[model samples]
Target: MLGVRLDTELEERLANVARTQGRSKSDIAREAVRRYVELHDEAFRREARRQSQRASRRDTQEDYAFWEQAEREDAAWR
Candidate 1:
């Protein structure tokens, strides 16, 4: 079981919100934690996808060789 210690003022705010929402403190805390984790996980996933796309845009040795050969052929025509 995990335990959290909140300052008195913070605890009071949480308690008030829980009362207003008609939720148990533990339930509210769990939902809040779940949403926080999900939000960050989604952001992390988006960044990872962007990083992969950036990496894929870079040239490989095979691509360089192919392009170089194509340039040489085009130069012969010039």
Candidate 2:
């Protein structure tokens, strides 16, 4: 079990919401924590997927050669 301490005002608000919704404060807090963690985990997974996708894109020799040519042209112009 996790113990959390909230500000007095927030605690009172939570209690009012809990009473109005007919749900225990524990239940509401648990669901909120679960959803928060789920969103964060999902965001991590998406970033991992993006990194893997970028890693899968191979840079060919021709691409490197083009950049080299561009750099030489810029150096000459300087």
TM-score of 1: 0.74
* Native-to-model Cα distance after best TM-score fit, residue 10 in candidate 1, in Å: 0.7
Clashing pairs in 1: none
How accurate locally, in lDDT, is each candidate? 0.95, 0.94
Runs of candidate 1 exceeding 4 Å displacement:
62-78
Clashing pairs in 2: none
* Candidate 2 accuracy as lDDT: 0.94
Write candidate 2's Cα lDDT for 1-78 as tens digits: 799999999899999999999999999999999999999999999999999898678676878899999999999999
lDDT of 1 at 4: 100
What does candidate 1's lDDT look like per residue over 1-51, in tens digits?
Answer: 779999999899999999999999999999999999999999999999999
The weakest ten consecutive residues by lDDT in model 2 span: 54-63
